[model samples]
Target chain A: MKKYTNTGSKDTRSGFGAGMTELGQKNENVVALCADLIGSLKFDEFKKNHPERFFQVGIAEANMIGIAAGLTIGGKIPFTGTFANFSTGRVYDQIRQSVAYSDKNVKICASHAGLTLGEDGATHQILEDIGLMKMLPGMTVINTCDYNQTKAATLALADHHGPAYLRFGRPVVPNFTPADEPFVIGKAIMLNEGTDVTIIATGHLVWEALLAAEALEAKGISAEVINIHTIKPLDDTAILKSVAKTGCVVTAEEHNFLGGLGESVARVLALNNPKPQEFVAVNDSFGESGTPEQLMEKYKLNNQAIVEAVERVIKRK
Target chain B: MSNTQQLQDFSTQVRRDILRMVHAVNSGHPGGSLGCTEFFTALYQQLLERKPGFNMDGIGEDLFFLSNGHISPVFYSVLARSGYFPVAELATFRKLNSRLQGHPTTHDGLPGVRMASGSLGQGMSVAIGAAQAKKLNGDKHLIYSLHGDGELQEGQNWEAIMYASAKKIDNLIATIDLNGQQIDGSTDDVLNLGNLKTKFEAFDWDVLEIKEGNNIDAIIKGMTEAKSRTGKGKPVCVLLHTVMGNGVDFMMHTHAWHGKAPNNEQLAVGLAQNAETLGDY
Candidate 1:
C-alpha cells in the first residue's frame, strides 16, 4: 500500500464533542442529555460551559430518550449521547415509540460503535444497531467518519427536525475529509475518482477505502472511493451512478454485513442496476475483548480484506 | 361557556362524547376514560389555568400529560369539548388515515397530544421530563400526569418516582388512576400492586388519596390541593380511587369492560345513564 500521509489521527468522539461545544455556543435551545457517558462521548466541555443545558441523566438511557422527547415539546433541540448498544438496543422501544414515531427532533448521538469499540467486548459493541434503527419508519441513520466530518454531522443533525441516529466510534483513524465540509443527510461524498470499480465505505472504513484505492492505483487499476455516511436513506442516485460508471462495487463498514450499508447498497443495485458487489464487514459472530486493530483483522474489516474484495468484484464484472 | 350551568353541561357532553367515540370506533379503551371523566373535565375546564384553544408550546398556564394514554377517548373528548379541535374529528377514530388511532399519537398533528403513548410505562418519565422543562423555563405553573395503578409495576415508573423525589422535583404533580384493574382481571389478581400509597410514601412522595375519584367536587378539591402542594421541595402524588366504569351502570365495577366496547343496545343504555347536556357529536 502506498503510504500517502500518516501525520495525524483523531478519535471520532472528539468530533462529536467539538461539534456540541460549537452548537452550545451558537444555539441557546441546543441541549445535551447523556447516560453516564459524558466523558466517553467527549461532552465534558459542553457540560462545563453550559451546565444548565447539559443533563447528566446517569446511566439510564431509556429515561434519557424519554426526557429528550419531552424537551422537544418546548422547542428545544436535544442531543442524546451514549454507547451504540445503550443508545439503540437497550432503548429500542423507547426510541421507536417516543422519538421516531412521535416525530420528536431528538439527535441520538452514539459513540464507540461496532467491534471498533475494542476492549469493552461484544456486550458493549452493538453490531445490530444500524439494522435496529433503520427498521424504524422515520429515522435518519448517519455513520460519520473521522474527526471533522463527525463534528460537522453532529452540528447538522441539530438543525434537522425529526429523530436521527448519528453514530461514531472509539478508534482514531485518519482525518482526511475536508475540515469544513458541510454535512448533508441522504447524500454520498466521492473522495477519489476512478473507472475500474467503486469502493464505498462509512465510519472508520472511509480512510481504509482511500488506502485501498491508492493501492489499486499502484497496481495499474483505478478505484473510485465513495464515502456513504447516511445508511438509511441509501443514496440511490449516487450508488447507481457510481456503479454504472465503474461496473463493480465494494462496500465496507465496521458493522455486520447482514443489514449494514452493504446490504442497503445491494438492495438498491439489485433492483434498478444490478452489478458485482463485495462486502467488507463482520460475519455472523460476536466480538471478543481485544485491541481495536486485532478485532479489525479478526473481523476481516481491514484495508487488505477490502482490497481483496475489490479485486474479486472486478473479476466478476 | 360562561355560566355554571354551561360548565356542568360541558362535563355531561364530554361524558356522552366519550361513550359515542369509543362505540363508533369499536376498538377503543373506555374503562379508564370513563373512570376519570369528572377529574379530567375539572382539570381542563375549571382547574387548570389554560386558554380555550391548545398551543404546542403552552406557556404561562399549566400542562397535563396522559401517561396512561389508553384513555384517549376521555382525553380527546375533553380536549375537543374544550375547543382544541373540531368535534367531528372524534368520529375518525381507528379508521385508516384517521387522526385518532387506537393508541394516542401526535403524528397526525393532533393539537392536544404532545407525545405518542401506546406502549405503556413511558408516560411517567415523559411527564416528569415535562415538569423538569417547566422548571427550566422558570414557569411557576405545575405539570400534571395521570398513570394507571397497574402500570406501577413498570420499572420506569419507579425510576421516575425515585428520580423526581431524589431531585426534589417540586414543580411537578402526578396522579395515579387507582382503578385496581388490568385487562386480564382484577389488579389484585393480575399482578397484585400490593399497596401503592405506601409505595409512594416509601419512595418519598407527598401522597394524597382521593376517596371518590369520580366526584367532580372531590376531583376539584384533590387537584387544587395537589397543585398547591407543589413548589415545596417535593413532588406530589394523588392516588385517585376511581371506579373502573363510573357513570354507566351495566359497565361499572367489572374488569370485562376494561377493553370491550359496548354493544349497540348497551351503548343506548349507557348513553341514557348520562344525559346529553351538550349536543351529541
Candidate 2:
C-alpha cells in the first residue's frame, strides 16, 4: 500500500475561506454573499479584501439565493455561504426557480454538514443536503474530504459555469491530499490498489476508508480505496473498473444510505455488473448533539465500521 | 418617442392580444393582464431605455422582471409587440413545445425575460441583485420589476424589501399591481394590505402612486416621476391602483376573471370593447 500522511489538521471551512481570498485577487467578477454566518463560514478575509464584491444579506437565505441568481445575469459569479440545512432545504424553491431552472452560475457553499457539526444537534447538522442538491437537474454536487481537497474544489468552481453545491464540514480533520493537486469536478481519486474488496467513500469518510484499508491489510485482507468527491455526474468509470477487479464493494459517506453515495453505486452496479455491496452510512436517522468524535463512533461512521462493511461484503462475494 | 395617441393605440392592440391569446388557450389570467395593459404598454413602448435585439446579459440597457407571472398574457403581448420576439409566436402561448411556458421563464431561451417567476415575491430580490451588479459594473441604467399586491403576503418580499433599503439600492423601481383581488376574493377580504404607501415609507422606500393606473398618460407621468426619484439614496416603489378588469365592463369590479378565460361570447365583447389598432398576432 502507498503511504499517505496528514501534513496538518485543519477545518474545511477555512480552506474555503482561503480559496475565496485567493479568488478575490484573481477573479474580479467573483462576489461573496453571506446570510449572517460570515465568521462561521470563514469568509472574513475575502470580505476584508473585496468589500465592494461582498454582500451581507442578513439572516434571509431565500433573499440571498435570489440575489445570487440575479447577480449572474450581468456576468458576476456569486458565491452564497450558509449552513448545509439552510443552504439546501430553507431555500430550495428559491434555488429551483431562480438558479437551477433559470440556469444561473451560482455557487452555493455550505459548511457544518452531517453529524460532524457536533453540539449544534440535528437542526444545524444536515445529512440530507447531498441528496437534495443532487436531485436538482443540472446541479453539480461536490463534497470534499479534507482541507486541501476543499480549497482546490473551491478554486475549480470559480471557472465552472452553472449552479453548483459545494458541501463541507465544521470539524477539523486530517489534511492528507497534496497542496498542489489540480481538482477535477467528476473524477474519483484512487487512494490504494488491492484485490480483495473496493471501498468507495466521499466527504470525511474518504480518510476513514484509508484507515480501514490499513486495518484490513493487517488482517491478511487486501482492499482498494477510492475517493468520490462529486456525487452528481458521478465517476462511474473508475468505480466500475475497481469493482470489476475486486468483485465486491463497500460504499461509505456521512449521509443516509437511502440517498447518498451507496444508493448511487448500487444503481450503477445493478444495471451493468451486479456485485455484492455493503453500505457504511447513517441508517435513515437524524443526528443529535455530541462531539464529532463521539457522534462518528456512535453512528458507526469511523474506520472500524468501514472495516466491518468490507469484511461483510468480501464474505458475500 | 411615441405620442399619447400612439401609446393608446399600442395599449389597445396589447389588450386585444391578451384577450385573444387567453381565449384561444381557454386558460390563463386575463384580469390582472387587462388591468395592467396601460402600464405594460407605457413601460415597454415609451419608458424603458432599451437596445435592439436580445442577450441574457443585458448590460448598458434597462431590465424588467415580471414577479406575478400568471399575468403572462400582457407581458408576452408587450414583449412581442415591442420586438423582443416575433409577434406571430404569441399564438404558441401555453401550448405543448412552446417557448412561452404557463409562467414566464428564461429557461426556453425566451428573449426579454431575465429570470423565471411564477413563484411570487422573488423578483424584487432578483431586481435588487441586477441593480447591485449595474452599480458594480459602472452601468448607469436602472432595473425595473412588477408584482401583484397579493404577492406581498409572501414573507420573502419583506426580506427583499428590507434588504433593498438597507443596501440603498436606488437604481430599482418595483411597481405593485394594486388590483385589490387575488384567487380567493378582494384584497380587503383575502388579507387587508393596510396603508401600503405608509408601509413602504416605513421600509425607507420612496413611494409614489398612479391612481388612474388604467390611463396611459397617467402611468407614463407617474412612472417617470418614480424614475426621477432614483439615484437619490433610496429605492422607489410605485403603487398602481388599477381596476381588476379595467377595459371590459362586464369583467370589472370582481375577481371572477383573475385566472379564468372569457368564453366565446364574452371574448367577442372583450375584443369589441378594445378595438384592434395594430392588428392581431
- Candidate with best DockQ: 2
Estimate TM-scores for all models: 0.96, 0.99
Local distance difference test, each candidate: 0.86, 0.94
The residue pairs in collision within model 2 are none
lDDT of 2 by residue, B1-281 (tens): 99999999998899899889999999999999999999999999989999899978899999998999999999999999999999999999999999989899988999999999999889889989999999999999999999999999999999999999999999999999999999999999999999899999999999999999999999999999999999999999999999988899988878999999999999999899999899889
- Cα lDDT of model 2 by residue, A1-317, tens digit: 87899999999999999999999999999999999999999999999999999999999999999999989989999999999999998999999999999999999999999999999899988888888888899999999999999999999999999999999989999999999999999999999999999999999999999999999999999999999999988999999999999999999999988788899899999998999999999999999999999999999999999999988988898
Candidate 2 chain B least-lDDT 10 residues: B244-253
lDDT of 2 at B65: 87
Instruction: Please give, for residues B37-133, the per-residue lDDT of candidate 1 as tens digits.
Output: 8778888888777855667657677888888878888898888888888888888877889888778898888888888997888887777677777
For model 1, state the Cα shift of residue A215 in Å.
Answer: 1.8
DockQ for each candidate?
0.66, 0.84
**CAPRI-style quality class for the chain A–B interface of candidate 2:** high
**Interface RMSD in Å per candidate, to 1 decimal?**
1.2, 0.6
- Model 2 reaches an interface RMSD of 0.6
Candidate 1 chain B, poorest ten consecutive residues by summed lDDT: B1-10
* C-alpha root-mean-square deviation, each candidate: 1.8, 1.0
